[model samples]
Target chain A: MNLPQPLQELIDQFESLPGIGRKSAAKLAFYLLNVPQDRLNRFSQALTDLKVKTHKCDRCFNLTENKRCSLCEDEGRDQSLLCVVEEVTDLLVIEQTRKFNGLYHVLYGRIDPLNNLGPEEILAPQLLSRLVKEGGKIKEIILATNPNMEGETTAMYLKSKLEELRTKKSLDFKISRLAYGLPMGASLEYADYGTLIQALDHRNGF
Target chain B: MNLPQPLQELIDQFESLPGIGRKSAAKLAFYLLNVPQDRLNRFSQALTDLKVKTHKCDRCFNLTENKRCSLCEDEGRDQSLLCVVEEVTDLLVIEQTRKFNGLYHVLYGRIDPLNNLGPEEILAPQLLSRLVKEGGKIKEIILATNPNMEGETTAMYLKSKLEELRTKKSLDFKISRLAYGLPMGASLEYADYGTLIQALDHRNGF
Candidate 1:
């Protein structure tokens, strides 16, 4: 026999999520059947509030509940050095490292030509306008997008645009992309070919 | 900076689910952020209805929206044969095989001494009462519980109780257990010692 309507609907919703299969979805639905009513209600409330209670930062496009994100509002952050990333999650990952004191610009996506995404599809225009508005105050713009092909394409596109703007508008910010090499603690035996080549080309002086 | 409150709560809820880690929870929460408002609402509604709109089948303990589950209400099924399982999920698994037309009894859980669960903690008493109610109608009782320790304990306990009831009430049902052997597609080299021993003990005629 088929599952009850409510259970079936919940299973279908769970299956629609990334990486969850039909069996896993049904398992989750079954597990939730025994959860306390209040906890289930809280989970449902959180789902409803996830989109309703949050908005994007006006300046950087990072997620926020207020007019601007905490990173954007903090005056202690280094405004002169901005890091541009492809998504809010990437910004959060960098923030967790506690190494970056500068503000961030969330591009929302990368330049994926295979999927019909271009520079225009991302927040490239917004980044340029923001830079133009900031003028000479920002000394450096870090392209911290992912290190894949689409990320490389986005960084290259942004770099050329920033260089053209530097000459045309007399901007003073230097553009830089994230360094490429073997990840820390990763063995050379397992490292991919592209990473090995990049490591050799960008070898640090002893 | 930490995630927004609503997003963080959703992530925490996702993390509480079995097999979902912190990173996967965050990924699911972020993925849902982009889901359409209507879909999100539907997902939220489903979660609310999962518990509120469904209940245990009065006769068999399987999950159902109505008083009696479809399995119990069906007149075409073989009421004389009853298969006792540990959970509703197991009943569904057996039903998916489509080999059994018999009615089912869900024990809800198994006896586990490590967890302090006894025969009374499960639906053993309920099963006895149901057998008494059915009396001589049920011709055979299949112990279809899992082959694990707790399942074995539950089945053993139920068998003794059924034997006592059969003597007292003069019920004519014969009790039986599912066979133990190698699973269909499992290789002999990889099969565990217990399975190999069981397969040897229960060798079938060619």
Candidate 2:
């Protein structure tokens, strides 16, 4: 318990992160202690620079090293299709799939009524503004929030909001939700009841 | 992919830590972004000071802010008893039990042959010197390494080495390995064969 304040502080900082607990934080701190001094310095420098260097992409709210995110500026991606995700991590996951070729709008968070995070706390306004600013250039809006309860609520809210925008602004874009079904290669036995119901309800022709 | 260099660097550094990968690293980095700037600055300062503030206690090789670790300097602990462990984490685990009132000698690592880690790489020599310097003042040594393969090998090596030291220095201390048995409340049916055998071999007279 008599650790140097800095070492203890490092452990506390690590514990403050999402998944790390006391033991894991201590393990990481000790691991850092063994790491070469220059690497530790670089790591510290990186942490300091993370605050000084990075900012959100003004256009899409995506994190960027620049004034705008690469996805927002990329000419090759479809400008007419935008995927709305709850976070940049989701964007990265979708990017990994290589199936979606559209631009993204990272909401940073979804509506969680229990946690008191409403539409206002997240990037809902930015999303609306982005859609309006792009206008007829965007032909489709994909509601790609997570599949959980909050995500479902957020998707419904966005659906109504987008529908209102379409009616008021006469926007020429369509709104769609990501499909729900058993994941690829997953067995029906292991699939939960709700997922099975979704798979059954959304069955497609052979 | 065009993340600002500092954010990317922080992600890379987070990824370098044990158990943290690319996605978790990115999540931590992004989470740090939303954290208040002063908090981030404090985290950065903590990381920077970790190296500057911490050092190994010369006596036990345990991490400390000073020349000696708290356990090594505590007057209330039994100086006659020393528990040898592979890491500080192990020391912490033993301390949590509150069953032992002895000092510790942290090996800092186990003798992992497959990883090419030998006695020389760890703090085996320091344990030997400490034992010699303390001589007849120390009454017992508990080899409290973990119950795994690497820990077992390390314990065996330490036992033999300490025996040699006892003979050379004419030390009058008892060297004991921690008892092996079925963990408290664990079912005999669930116990593995090796563990059952150990429990049977070390069974006490009722």
TM-score of chain B of each: 0.97, 0.92
**Which pairs of residues collide in model 1?**
none
Per-residue alpha-carbon lDDT of candidate 1 for residues B1-206, written as tens digits (9 for 90 to 100): 97778889999999999999999999999999999988889999999899999999988899999999999999999999999999999999999999999999999999999999998789889889998987788999999999988899889999999999999999999999999999999999999999999999999999
Candidate 2: tens digits of C-alpha lDDT, residues A1-206: 45677888999999999989988898899899878888988887887778677778898878787789888878999989999999887887888888998898889899999999999988888888877887789999999999999999999999999899888888988899899999999988899999999999999999
Please report the TM-score between candidate 1 and the true structure: 0.96
Give the runs in model 1 whose Cα sits over 4 Å from its true position: none
lDDT tens string, model 1, A80-190? Answer: 999999999899999999999999999999999999998889999999999888878899999998999999999999999999999999989888888999999999999
Q: How does model 2 score on DockQ?
A: 0.59
**iRMSD per model?**
0.7, 1.9
lDDT of 1 at B148: 88
Task: Please give each candidate's TM-score.
Answer: 0.96, 0.83
Please compute DockQ, using alpha carbons, for every candidate against the native two-chain complex: 0.83, 0.59
In model 1, what is the error at residue A124, expressed in angstroms?
A: 1.4
TM-score of chain A of each: 0.97, 0.93
